[model samples]
Target: MRAASVLEADEGRLPVVASEPQSASGLATRLELLRNTLRPTPHVPLAMEGMNLFAKLEYVNPVGSIKDRAAYWILKRAAERGEIRDETTVIESSSGNFAAALAAFTRLVGLRFIPVIDPNISGAYESFLRRICPTVVKVEKRDDTGGFLKTRLQMVKHLCATTPNAYWTNQYGNLDAVEAHYELTAAEICADFESLDSVFIGVSTAGTIAGVSRRLKERYPKVRIIAVDTEGSVIFGGTPRKRHIPGVGSSIVPQLLSHAKIDDVVSIHESDTVEACRALLRTHGLFVGGSSGTAFAAIKRYASRMAVSNRPTVLFLCADRGTAYLDTVFDPAWATRLE
Candidate 1:
């Protein structure tokens, strides 16, 4: 069932709201399109009952994470441009979510996936990918020296160079992720919501910043797109330092970030992130990952900046269940370690 009509002052320029599907194949098509059209899932915050805070539940996507959107977009775009075919094996390096998503989706479409993972990731995450992907390559995260994720990716590049047919999604630095978010997420925010005060999001490679910020600016030029980075991330001009928050806190600003005109970059502490993840689990039944926990912390901080009314403020849970983070974020001793 669809809702009633909505037209704004500059409505026609906006693309039609993406239509939902009713069947399995139809659902696949819808999800594929969703990579180019993510919608805001509305929800009310407990702290603010009368004043609703819309947290876009991105974890609902098929692959148990929002990275599924980027996967679909980049893959389809690749198909369109003759970059990949059915026989072409898919490849990428990821902490877990992106690789897991690629593995699942490649299986669904009868394609092969190669996941390049680092030793720093959780053991369970490694096991999960091994089950999904046809081939799993682990890179050393050594204290002294190891090629790690970066080195593993270079290895894949070398393999692809020699191999006859392989498709590298290259999501870490891929502009496709940025373009995917731009097409789907940012546009949805402008169309569905009216006059959003601020949006809180965790930054990884800054693709979300470029994508989400671009569309928000197109709609409400004054809309506040505060790019949230973890304590160790270089995104907020911080010195590169180690942090517990995963899927975020990169050592350098992503290449895609150059195109985005970000309003403000705020860095949050790891302690706040761990606490917020617990709060989400206890209160909302949302066991989100470290980056989402970081996002939640920023949402609280950004919410203070929002007008104390029913005005909608938005944030996102980028991936699904903290089952992946159980050993760390969900563990008491882990919290104690951070504390």
Candidate 2:
């Protein structure tokens, strides 16, 4: 059955897919179970004076990151559209969270996944992907901006052209990535909070912020959509430099970002990102990823400028777990170098 036939789209809400239990054996049954097992992550309140702050604990998702939502939705939609067959191989270029997500989901649905990764990938993520995937492609060359994203994309294209029945997920340009957040992640936030003054989102491929900002603006017209980017990222037109953090910045601006309704852009330094990560662990006991720390630092800076009487109710996404950063952000020596 075609996805269009099985899923009904609503004007202002998520598309409803068929939820009936499948009696068929093998892949079909597993897909149904996977869909059924997917649940919304929680939003926990953070103690702060004047303004009500809450962090959406997206790290609790099956693959331990927000990318799981996008990975599942993209593959599911592709299968419905007849793009994924039993012999098809799914390919994507990612350094960390997204790569791990696609690996887990594709394996679950009986599809072969090959991640074109770079040397900058964290040890934890590299170990996980190598264990599950038969072949992991590594690109050693860097692009003009000294990042491997462009080089990785070139490898992805080459692999797709040479490999039979290869389907590239194309997370950077894929509308499915944006829709996943709009329909699932942002929808959850809107349902939880009737009113929000602003939302701080960390930018990478810009999928999460683009989708969440658009949806939140539709629900709360006046809510400020803040796009938090790293200093070296060119996403918001900043000069490109070497960025140490994996998921917080991008050398190339994502196409999905054009669809967002951004009110302001805040550029954060790597130093601040490290400090914020430690601060969250020390103060709130929330051990989140580098991007989450960047968002938190941006929120604190943004809030400092606001009048005390009008402190806004703030919401930020904790994109992934910090355990992957044990060798970097959570390391005192590593963090000290950034200082």
Q: Per-residue CA lDDT of candidate 2, range 211-292, in tens?
A: 8998999999999988999998999999999888999889998998998889999999998999999999999999998999
Best by TM-score: 2
**Against the true structure, candidate 2 has what lDDT?**
0.86
**lDDT tens readout by residue for model 1, 1-339:** 344232212422321222322333433443365443334544434454324556666776666767777887777677666676655777787877778777766655445678877776777778777665546777665322222445766767876786567878877678888887888767666677777766766777667777888887888877777777887567667866666656877765567778676777678888888888898878877767888788778877776666666556554544566778888888888778773
The root-mean-square deviation over C-alpha atoms between each candidate and the true structure, in angstroms, is 10.6, 7.8
